[model samples]
Target chain A: MTDTIAIGTADRKDAKTGTVAANRALAGPRVNGKAVVMTLYLVFLMLPIYWLVNMSLKTNTEITSGLTLWPRQITFDNYIRIFTDQSWYSGYINSLTYVVINTVLSISFALPAAYAFSRYRFLGDKHLFFWLLTNRMAPPAVFALPFFNLYSAIGLFDTPWAVALAHCLFNIPLAVWILEGFMSGVPREIDETAAIDGYSFPRFFVKIFMPLIASGIGVAAFFCFMFSWVELLLARTLTTVNAKPIAATMTRTISASGMDWGMLAAAGVLTIVPGALVIWFVRNYIAKGFALGRV
Target chain B: MTKTLNNKAWFLVLPVFAIVAFSAVLPLMTVVNYSVQDTFGNNQFFWNGIGWFQELLDPSKELGGRFFEALWRTLLFSAIILAIEIPLGILVALSMPREGWTVALCLVLMALPLLIPWNVVGTIWQVFARGDIGLLGWVVNHLGIDYNYTGDALDAWATIIVMDVWHWTSLVALLCYAGLKSIPDAYYQAARIDGASRWAVFRTIQLPKMRRVLLIAVLLRFMDSFMIYTEPFVLTGGGPGNATTFLSIDLVKLALGQFDLGKAAALSLVYNLIILAICWVFYTVMTNVDADRERVEA
Candidate 1:
């Protein structure tokens, strides 16, 4: 399927060059319109983020005093404070810890299950798959209190493990769903060939099959990381102090003195960095991943 | 693809099953337990079967009124989000550059909003839409339309809806772009040869080709919007007067704030059931659509 799309793209490139004059005449206005639409939409998307970044660079007094598109007196005090303070910087560490754990856990657990669903017809497989998907739809609000009790009773509360494990409620299902889609796209002949080659199931899976779906695994892990990092409700509820996510710690921006606009904007800006970094790593797979590999 | 029957495959699935069951089932059981029973301070409990559920469903009761109001508001919010996002997403996806370095740049920037923490998204909008300092709020006020999300219920609703659109529309667009990418140039060539109008090509070819991804996008948007909590909570704190208190906000208040476990549990169960029902419908439709497409191809 992907091969056909690649071929089609090459064909379009050839066609564009081949009929340059005629094609340009026909598509000129439409192309310009597309560029305009894209520019406007991208601007709409970036303006708010630009505002946040703008505020983060300014002093608290300047932030409250007036609106500024660009900071007149840029100061690093907010970023400096976050990096220097133990409480502030620790939140980022804590958030990264659980997000990493959850992504690893979700992808590892989902891998075998996804392979099973894709490669075999097991007892109640369809029902099981659907049931798993239903978990993705379960509201985090419904699970917050119960998770708090369950984790505390198990002595995992107020720890990164609690949030990581709790996050599995949704992330596992999602990983399995995405991985299954990617796995199903691979031909069954490969599995049969491996068997004919006298390969053990585990060896075939790890050495041969795993490499084939490496991008799928990357996509799944990316999604797992994205969800676990951004989720605040369960993360905040499960951990009060020691494992507080950067997002939860962000609430501290509301101090007794008043809202610390600069620090709040700084923390918000900082939260976007890890995500942006992750997106950069997975940029190629993102569109396909967002399709959950069904396409 | 064909699969061999192998019940033994369950072994491969056991780890996921165990972990998910531990995470999902155990907490779910706790919710069920809370739903049936009343609890006093120090966890003293009494039987309260059907009582909380009844109160939750009965509009005359205060609990029921709040639940129904939030449910309607949430449903309306989800509906409006879908109505706006799906069309806008398709437009953006259609406008995406077909090739070159800009593709990666567009995708990376488009995905940035999706990865931001929900509360940060709220904060961005909250700060961006403030009347005094927020660029959007300041600009809108400068236009001489009295716009204060902090004070006006209608403005609060609009701010939240717009914020959600900003955050999630990228997801829909990205999915649709994938769907569009999969279409072979042969289809376009054929349409061009036939001298088909752009709308004709889109209606007859692009839309049908995009059906699968669109369904996925719709299902995700609906579920996420319906369950939205952190963004609106941070942005409006459920508002000037419960104007933006969706289901999750109300549930958090009931469960955590008031410590009303029974009512919260009941609401949670009902809420889960509604989502489950909608999800089942979408799943059934998706499978049927897949089967139909397969049959047509065959």
Candidate 2:
């Protein structure tokens, strides 16, 4: 759609113009049915997340005792265990390692490819672009076995890099798509002017073009990090001992005795923290990216 | 909008191609190799060309029946989720406060579910929907619903669907909100000047503007619902006896659980082809719409 392309142009125009009247028109206080609907929806969204946090603070005995809206006795043991224990905390480090690698790899590789897609036509360009997207549509479950066999044969098995590389199959295409939207918005005249001013391609891209699309890169990176961070199946299958993710480790609580309800809830809460932090940082960019129809 | 014909751009795309090929192409080729063959351990494969594919396609056969059942279940799930979530998301987005701290708060809270690791989302709901300890299960039972998700098939389906709506409805809402925000106030003013009713304004201006983002929302929700695995896997483990077994879960059962590599490989190719075909249709429609817009603008 034209809706997608039109929004892209409209985004750049709005950013440059800073339409104050439009902002003022959309802003106001509402004390109507709409507010009630929004409030009820927020409650629905918050309750489950709140329940997870509530359970994390209770002892296993207390959790099994009965249904309580809030914990009667708040405890820090679950948090303390995660901090003190090597296995618990190492899971976070392992997850972070691959996620960071995947995000960096996806964005860096995607940058040049996105630039190509936005600016030029090469052999099989359209087909190649579509093929890239098709890879994103592949279910990770289907590829789990083959990825295991393929990575192990290459001797990259059980490593963070393997998960990172595997995640790139999806992330790269998405990064290219989002970044290309932003890149296309930058006037080609900027590139020509930079060239005429004696700047080389790399320098121009780094100093001029990159900054122009900094928010776009931020949005792309946010997506890559989120997808890689939350992914469980591929990460779990690819890495065994040294590079196990926290999501996988959380499942270990399902042992012979029973599930560790308290600790599992605690681990679940901890997994949310990094993502919350990232969203906090990228909050502005997400809205802008959405406006551009790039995400 | 014409692109410069520069073959040198291939150099720029080489890194992405190389990495994706290593991960996607080689593994995919392995799947293709396994699809047409017959294997019985010892790493020895037979030249049983098209045998597994035949078994998978013949509905009278066990494999074929299971595949169709799972496919149908997956399609039905996607349809139900889309029908509920899209309209609900639009309604929520319309109601969202447009200014002040409420905007930031809403954005963050709405994003919380999306950020939680998928399995943890299942875990949270698994705990939240428990008959013994969960608030929901306790309340529902007291209300005389006799709702036991672990025992009953309908309850299990309802739980998974509700859980998915809880998890992903925010995505549709956020995208629609973004689309709504992109519409200029001038449109509203013009509608107002014409004495347009609230419903008329929404129908004429808002719905039209939201179309592209809704398309994105539909495509995403469809593909994700089709390949849904983790949340349902954690919640039900694909049962109260295959009741909630969608395509991705079934494929995992065949590939990983049974280790029937040949049949699993054949199933995977079929599963992937369906996704490919549907996504291709979405892509072509989207591009054609884009092309039409460009023509009008020119």
Which candidate should be chosen as best, given TM-score against the real structure?
1
Global lDDT of model 1: 0.93
What is the TM-score of each predicted model, taking all chains together?
0.96, 0.94
Interface RMSD, model 2, angstroms: 4.8
Per-residue CA lDDT of model 2 for A73-94, tens digit only, reads: 9998989998999998999999
> Residues B1-298, candidate 2, lDDT per residue (tens digit)?
7789999999999999999998888999999998888878889989878899999999999999999999999999999999999999999999888688889888888887888889999998998999888878888999999999989999999999999999999889888898888889778667544445457778999998887788888888888888999999999998999999998899989988988988999999999999999999999987787787669869
What is the Cα-based lDDT of residue B291 in candidate 2? 82
Poorly placed runs, candidate 1 (over 4 Å): A1-26
Give Cα-based local distance difference scores for all models. 0.93, 0.88
How much TM-score does chain B earn in each model?
0.99, 0.98
Q: Supply candidate 2's per-residue lDDT for A153.
A: 98
What is the model-wide C-alpha lDDT for candidate 2?
0.88
